[model samples]
Target chain A: MIRYVIRRLLLAIPTLLAMLTMVFVLVRLVPGDAAVSMLGDQASEQALDALRARLGLDQPIHVQYLTFLGDMLRGDFGTSMSSGRSVLSEVWQVLPYTLELTAAAMVIGVLFGLPLGTFAALYRNRWPDYTTRLLSLTGLSFPGFVSGILMLLAFAVWLRWLPVMSSASSDPLTHMRNLALPALNLGLIMTAYITRVTRSSMLNVLGEDFIRTARAKGVRPGPLVMRHALRNALIPIVTVVGLYFGTLIGNSVLTEIVFTRPGLGKLILGALQSRDYTLLQGLMVIFAAFVILVNLLTDLIYAAVDPRVSYAK
Target chain B: MTPVLDIKGLTTEFRVKNGWHAAVRGIDLSVNANETLAVVGESGSGKSVTALSTLRLLPQTGARISRGEVGFGGRDLTKLSEREMSRIRGNDIAMIFQEPMTSLNPTMTVGDQIAEGLLIHRGMSRTEAAKEARRLLDEVRVPDPARRVNDYPHQFSGGMRQRAMIAIALACRPKLLLADEPTTALDVTVQAQVLSLLDDLKRDRGMAIVFITHNLGVVAQIADRVAVMYAGEIVETATCDTLFADPVHPYTEALLKAMPRVDRKAESLEPIPGSVPSISARPAGCVYAPRCNYVQPSCAAHPSLVPVGGNHEARCPVRADKGEAA
Candidate 1:
């Protein structure tokens, strides 16, 4: 298993590098002048040139990519072209907020989705099963941002329970309060996807003759879910969850906008708007690398859940 | 001897896309103390369903016992509440299943899997269960039980795993043991060994056993009484000797013939002409009329079971008096 993990980690490096390279090159190709966006129309040509030289935008694409690649290798992400702040510092500052929301959303999704899906599988075709299906369908249909906006309108605007729109600061313990609604909103779609995958996989596992053995052994519902059903169902749900995490990192921009929180998503948007080449490339690379690393962790987890998956090569 | 387990009119149904699919039609049989009653049938012939129904282990929405009385030790198990049923399962009435490879949990150790019932049903502490589990493994003839018990299910071979299953089932000294094709999946040598083990356990403990199988050889070797099931109902039932020697129903005859015997080498094996009838395509009256050898016009109207002799019965319009076909 240690060998398998090491091999997987090794393989992931090239993949992360390739992904970041693609995002960097693609973002650069989009028609925009970072210096012009930073200086705006009011700044003199000489001032823009000076700013370009300072940000290393004066160099050719190949030279700039080489420099960026070198700095990345050295763990330096350079400063934001718009704000003149260290890209790494900005990323560190915003990551907790994003992590807080995503983590809570994931927890909420699993807490409700796993059991509901298991129930749907256990009592398939019954009222509970039908209700779960209906709820999942509704969840899948509504976008997270739409749900977040509706929640903000309902809770903050009308009920005055939550603050209307503030870039809420991240707190470890109480961050849940600020993130709960946004998390649920982001989680609605994930919950649906996970629940659907789980229900199918749970049904398949439950139908196996082995489940009969567990039942005959008199293992109760909760233990049965934890031990037999969920573990087996995870083989498929793991793939969906892994892919969802990547999409979650990417699509979080809209959710952050809706919730009025300072996170990776808002930073990414700012970088894109101002054509902050250094910061944008750095952010993209960081996001891509982080996502790849998380996926690698998820793969290891999936292997642990299923023994047949070797990860040998 | 008092019956350790009694089942009457055990009919089971599953809700389907169109309507309810009757998985197990009306059937009845019982197992006396220390006796092994083998309910023999092909796959999907309701043998497994009957066993699951007795334990009330079928998935709730998919299946229901439309009519039945599973009387165990004077209590109607079919009528028992969920709590009472849960108490009965794996405690008073234990079951060892087929597919020994998958039957045991992959993630857990063999000892923990066996000890699970002890802790859950018997209320034994983990330490106590672990200690007793090693002893039980030793009893099942597992080698190095002390160390082997700590090993996971995957570490054991096919035979060893089945032995572990038996240990789990017999842990609480259940009065009635339900074994669903315990040896059907095993090889010949393993099958013989498992049968012998089951026989020995039954004899020693005087525990009644409901052995489900399609293999007549295993039944002949182990069962005290035999219930020959066709399309979800018991078509014929008799003492092991009588059922084998003077098999009455055509389906029973076909099953006996279907089995490959070592005593005789025949020119060509007679494969049953058609496939087992589907649950969806069940005929109006007779379930096995399309497949029977001595099938008659009256056979179209399904024959209810009637006594042919003392403690021997069959379900056929044309009784065995009109003997074998041709």
Candidate 2:
């Protein structure tokens, strides 16, 4: 099994390379000139051209790609066209906050979703099942931004319990508290999805003839759910959680803008607005890598949960 | 003598959208000490429903036992609470289902399932139960009982799984064991092995057994008495010798004639003329009238079981007076 995963990871290199090529070409073709934009319109024509030449923008696209690839292999992402700072430094500066938000939201989602789903599945066609089904419907119906605004209004405006927005701060705890609402907004929707998956998977497993056999053998309900039903249900839940975790890395795009947290999402937005081409490319690359890595870890964790699954050739 | 287990006027019905439909209608049966009573019927003939109703294990949401008294050891099991019933199950009256492949948990080791009753009812420690389970496994003639006890259900073949189930049923020395076609899932050779094991276990422990199966051949071998059930009702009951030798009910006679006897048959064996009545769509009058060769005008109304001879009876009015005339 370990050998299989190692091989899969090795094979992912080409897949990642193909994605990198597509993203690189797509971003470059999109109309903004990173080198010219770096000098801004206020600068003279001469100054823009000089900056372009200095940044290797005067070269053909192929030449630029090779140089970028060489530099990337040697661990250099180049300086940001907008901020005139290292692209790598800016990414590292904002990544931790994004990680914190994603982590917090995921924990919240799992905490809320798994039990509700299990109970709903256990008492299917009953009151608890209907209640969860209703709650999930409500959760998924609202868009993230709207949900974020409403949470802000309820907690910050009426209740006046906590701050509605997040700012970059040295103290991560305060930053986390401010970030919680938007994170939970994203989490609520994910919880709805994961719960439905858990309920269906668990319900199917519980209906198997083996489950009745367990009950017949006098195994109690609690252990039967945990040992038999839940373990099997987790296979699908694992896949959903893994996909959600990968998506969380990308959540920084909209989620950060809503919460105004100084994270990768905000970084990407700033890069886009200022037209920092190098920084944008670097951030996209990092996000892709993080998602790929997180998904790999999730796959490994899923294997641990259910031994029957192994990465195929 | 008091019956080891007695089921009287047992009626189970399902609540459909329109109304209640009787699944098992007022069937009466009794098992005496060390006696084997084979309940025989085809699928949906309420054979399994009767077995499950004894423990009140029927799906309770849509299913309700309209009336019944399942008296075992002088206590009516039907009157017991879920908690009390759980305590009784695997303790006093154990049951083994038809599909041993599914009746045992796949993820759990066979020994754990076998020892489960001991742990639940006997309060046996895990270590003690494991040892006892191995011994039971060996007693059931399972190969390499000590080592194989740690193996899961998947490790055992079909025959071995049935043996493991038998080991579990016999764990607490239950007074009565309800086997719902224990050999039905096995190949012919394995079927014979399981049947002999059941016979040996019954003789050795003196435990009364209520064996439910569709195969009359199996009934002839192990059953001391046979009850033929049709459309949720027992239409005939007789000692094994008399049941196979001088069957009286038209349904019983039809079944006897349907039997493919290698020694006695000349032409192709005759099948019962019509299909067994559907449980959901039972006939208004006689359930088997559509299939009976001797359907009299009176058979338009369902006939109640009437005694015909010593320790033998059939649910046919014509058999009591008209003999075997069609």
Q: Which candidate leads the pack in TM-score?
A: 2
Q: Is model 2 an incorrect, acceptable, medium or high docking prediction?
A: acceptable
TM-score of chain A of each: 0.90, 0.92
Model 2 residue pairs with clashes? A252-A265
lDDT (tens digit, per residue) of candidate 1 on B1-326:
76888889989998777688788988888898899999998877899999989999988766889997888988899888887887788898999888898888776788988898899888999999999999999988899999999887778999999999999898888999999998877888988988898899999999899999988888999999999888888888999998998888888888878788878676444667787687777888778888877778887786798888778888886865643331
DockQ values for all predictions?
0.48, 0.40
- Tell me each candidate's RMSD, in Å, in order: 3.3, 3.0
Give the per-residue lDDT digits (tens) of candidate 2, residues B98-120.
88877776656788888878998
Compare the candidates by lDDT and give the number of the best one: 1
lDDT of 1 by residue, A10-118 (tens): 8887886787678668877889677777778888999989988887778998898788777887889888777888999988988988887788778877888887898
Instruction: Note the clash tally of each candidate.
Output: 0, 1
Model 2 misplaced stretches (Cα beyond 4 Å): A54-58, A62-79, A84-86, A168-176, A307-313, B264-267, B321-326
Docking level of model 1? acceptable
List model 2 lDDT by residue over A185-232, tens digit each: 778877887788889998888877667655665567787798767877
